[model samples]
Target chain A: MGINSVTTMSPGVGAKLRRMHPLPIRIMHWVNAVAMFIMIGSGWKIYNDEVIFGWLHFPEFLTIGKWAQHGLQWHFLGMWIIFFNGLAYLTYGFATGRFRRMLLPIAWRDVVATIKDSLRLKLSHDDETKYNAVQKLLYIGVLLAGVMIVLSGMAIWKPVQFSELYFLFGDFQTARLIHFFCMAAIVGFVIVHIALAILVPKTLVAMVAGGPIVSDADQSGARHMNETGNHP
Target chain B: MSKPPSRSIFRPSGKIDSSILQADPKLLYEIDRRKVIRGAVSLGALSFLTGCNVSEVDQVQSALRAVSTWNDLAQSVIFRPNHLAPTYPESRVVKPPRFNAHYNIEDVQPVDVNGWKLELSGLIADKRPWRASDIYALPEQEMIIKHICIEGWDYIGQWSGVNLKTFLERIGADLSAKYVAFKCADDYTESLDMASALHPQTMLATKYAKELMADPFGFPLRLRTATKIGFKNAKWITALEVTNNRPQTYYEKEGFNWFSGM
Candidate 1:
């Protein structure tokens, strides 16, 4: 029952997992994912209604829900979920030292070394015991991006209500662009993260079945898991 | 897939083989300031994928415009004909009402009401010009309602004026008209759906806080509706046209959503 501890279990070797992600983290992760999905879809549909580019908008196919109102409704409802969930996640991160555990105290040398080792296929640092330098940077970067996205979203949603946030982004329109940019960036992370999950089966399994699994993540998976979000 | 470079004269890169600027007037100006015009590039790549040339500006423009218009139509369809925007009490009114305009407040011209006239046209049966006194003489009603602004501000203020719904009924305007366009003396123009014009809270506001609104506020008269954002509360009114034609609003022309609902 050493799930918290990574283990290599083969068939007939009963795998009693101790740790990977606790139930709360798993639940929050999926909740966050669902909320993000709703937000992106509704966000795109609402964007279509406004036609910001002065040209082509997101084709209807990429958007979520049926109509602009439907999108608007879902987008707004999802906003509260995202806000509260984000708050909970952030509070947990800071309160449990997971925020610090996930991010900092890395030397510049370590970052350069990580890059060199990654490219050289030498940074097989995905032990799941802790995050590597690159993983830390990406996690922190994405977290900050999430915060900005929410703030900018609020700015756009109620510019008059939250004039400071609106003005901080320069205006309603600029805040909108900032929100869209952050959304796209997070989506990009989602794609890379999913692909990494494919490469490192244990990382995926660790999240799902809990882990007492093999630690020999395929080298590419190791780099990807280390580089993406060593979500523990 | 291999592709050809665009040879459009107005393209940002000076590459004109295929591009999006041909369709949108703002694209060229937008790209000049933004180092990376994300939409154009993404569309250009998408055009390449679909084997489309950027030269089809008219079709692309029409398609995008169609979507915008469709959004308007959808909103119109969903608009509750009988629904009214919520009203607030005296205490909710924000003091020193926020002043907002496209241009700075200092530049607002004090329109001379002595000879000022409210021009009327389009579907209305009466086309005679109206005066400030004529507006003041109308049956007065007061409602302290939240004025929502698209710029993201809100305030409650008691606006007293002739109820626009009653005025329209009295004027014998074609109530079935599609849009009620307001042309401001300051050159800003905006429009509202007929349904919105008939909403119970819709008023031709003459006074703010129990006194005639100063010129900086929409003097003589301005639209005061409970539901719409601030931009819809156009000021310095000089003309009104009720018509089926989808006239372009000043902000709408500048890329704001036409049916910008709450």
Candidate 2:
């Protein structure tokens, strides 16, 4: 169960072991992080121009653009980046079986247990390579939110041309509300995500520079356990 | 980095002596001195932090504009000529439709109906001017469509007038032209792509909510296209030009997207 026991190989051989995060995943993650930041900042500026809730207005310093039009320019730029980057990430995730390997089979029982342990501050961070039930749920939730934000954005952008999507969210006003909530969900997720990363700093480093490596046998063994419904 | 020397003659507290203010009255106009200084510093810091020059900033802006232009092209390609903007029930129409313009409602100059003439030019076969009476004589089409503003507000408006495509055909306009540009009485100008100009829902709207549109709400005639954002719907239209050349609109000149379709 020790780190040394998991990898009995030398440094050179350790280099050959599967990385906790592959190069492509790491690149996509960072690119998405920048895109998300730009999108959120500019989106806030756009929202402030005409707020849904009259009482709420985001501060100017926290926003990306100096004016509403300027915010629109930044928002559009961020939109293109996030759209293409997200498409690439999804493609890579499904094609490479990354989704199956990293995030799958969320049992309600396990999720409830994970939540209970998390509340008690007894949740383990022993396996940096694998995501716990809570982590899996969060990742999946944020991913869904990302997709919803984009779709709702499209609905808002072209309510006439993309009328199907517009009606899917009921109306133009409702679509805007949906887009706003999706953004809120993403911001919340990012706050928690960053806080957790700070608590367990290695997770942050793992995303940036690949963390502990798993040997071929260990990876396949983990996959076998996943398939046989014996995941620890 | 070494701190730059202070350029302001004002005190560190930003307090100006009355004698200094009297010495140069122009100093009184520098009320945003702090803001200007902060802006300049931030601009410098931004360029330094990003390792970007003024030229690079310009390059980034041009690139974004290019993307916006590309979006315009993409929208046109996907724009179904026959596809209609969603319509609403008659009950949903807002009475006394919200007024929006570059200037205030009090500043809206009412055009004399008798003196008003719809001038025609550009690629049209007939360049003759039509009076307001002539426009009213044309077959009127009515629509209760959502008027969406770029600022994200929307309202159901019941607009009724001559269908633009029908009017264009009657006026002997070259429908093949790339653009249909409008010149308004209020000095506001707007243009639409040929496809949008020919849309069934696009109209030379003269009435709102079953009444002649008020002066502040584009009286006489206006371009009311459901497919475009509210700004693209020019009010108080005085002239129509059919041309291959793209006409620069008032808002477009101010950096708003030209083809601001819904």
Candidate 3:
């Protein structure tokens, strides 16, 4: 129950818990992860040809004139996958009570305790069951970032339909700048998340096997798999 | 301890029994539960995946194009289209509205309105020049039509101008001239295929809203071509050259589409 007293449960306990995610959520999470990575990589190569950065003489696909257009094509195609995947995950989260488990905090007291324990690296395996304050913050940040990417992408893509959005970003060029920056933020966050997963083996196993070693030591029982939404 | 036996979940139930007994009980129990869970999940997922058809991308790009093309063909269809650009009332007209896009005009030397002449040259048997007054004396038509900006805003106003078709006929344009290229006073140039240039609605406007055209809106003379985005209507005319090939404009030179016709 406490930080120092993480009683090791039997080997079979990790295999018995009911999975928090249905299969749909799991598939969507992994598919979206792959799509987002490809989008970012291809996006970078395409972004190099932009006039805004032309002064840097950034080398890109040397023979191609409009690398940006091709980048846009890939980004647009990848968008379909990410959009549907996200929609499925959100519907499942709301339909099942799982949204509250990972999304809504148990209480502010738990949040405060999480921050305190995380600050000292004294959190037990059970403590990770409920997201730590930092983890919660990052999770919320990434979701909001996703929304920003969608909105800004639309603003740039269909500036005519959303005139006010053009006013918000000042112009097409400005909207494009913001969209690119938001994508970079998401990529950076994902890298940090993967590093953290590798740092904790049980977190990885729980996501892959559908249950964590802390089965007896925790209340939620289900380990967080789709945190960064990278699991297959 | 042996690893749990793996069998195709979708295979007939008969194949599963033989594979079931040769596995660890704990691992087998988890696998059995997973299989049943996955089968139910696959069904639900199939339905959900079908429901999750986010067609916004397809809708936004092709919907208007499809509607316009349909109207062009089915001329008898009576349904008023929704995406048609709105017509504005005269009372709502903004006096001295800000100019939208300024290009080569700002950097170029001004053309003398008095001495200015439109030179009809390029792949033509005869090169002729027409004065502004000469063009003004030709048969004129007036129509209060909407100028729809590609930026999603539009203004309906009166436009009085000579038909481009009349001028081309007078010049006896060469048969090989497949395009009509306009050379602007501001170093901006634009070209259109012979088909678009000869459209009855396309006019080189001289007046706006029953009054002399405002300077900011291509005063004295400008092309008021319909069926294309607003940007195609280049302002502040200086020369018009009929040609058999494509020409470029300021924006087009800077990576914009060459043919912006609707």
- Return the top candidate by TM-score: 2
Q: Write the per-residue lDDT of candidate 1 for residues B182-244, one digit (tens) a residue.
A: 999889999899888888778899888898888888888899876567788889889988899
Q: Name the TM-score of candidate 2.
A: 0.82
For model 3, how does the per-residue alpha-carbon lDDT over B144-182 read when each residue is reduced to its tens digit?
A: 545555433455566778887776777787645667888
Could you give the DockQ of candidate 3?
A: 0.02
Best model number under DockQ? 2
lDDT of 1 at B121: 84
* Model 2 lDDT tens row, A1-232: 3445333333334334456788888998999999998899989988998899988999899998777776887887788889999999999989867777678777789899999998999857877777877888999999999999999999999999889888899988999999999999999999999999999999999898866665333432132112122322
Please tell me how candidate 2 rates in CAPRI terms.
acceptable
CAPRI docking class of candidate 1: incorrect
- List DockQ, one per candidate, in order: 0.05, 0.49, 0.02
Better of 1 and 3 by lDDT: 1
lDDT of 3 by residue, A1-232 (tens): 3322222222243443345444565677779888787577656655664434545433564323244434444555566677778777767767755656576665677777877987797646554456665676788788878878877876654443344564688655677778877987898899988887788776666565554222322345444333322332
Q: What's the lDDT of the predicted structure labeled candidate 1?
A: 0.73
Q: How large is the interface RMSD of each prediction?
A: 9.6, 1.1, 9.7
Output the number of the lDDT-best candidate. 2
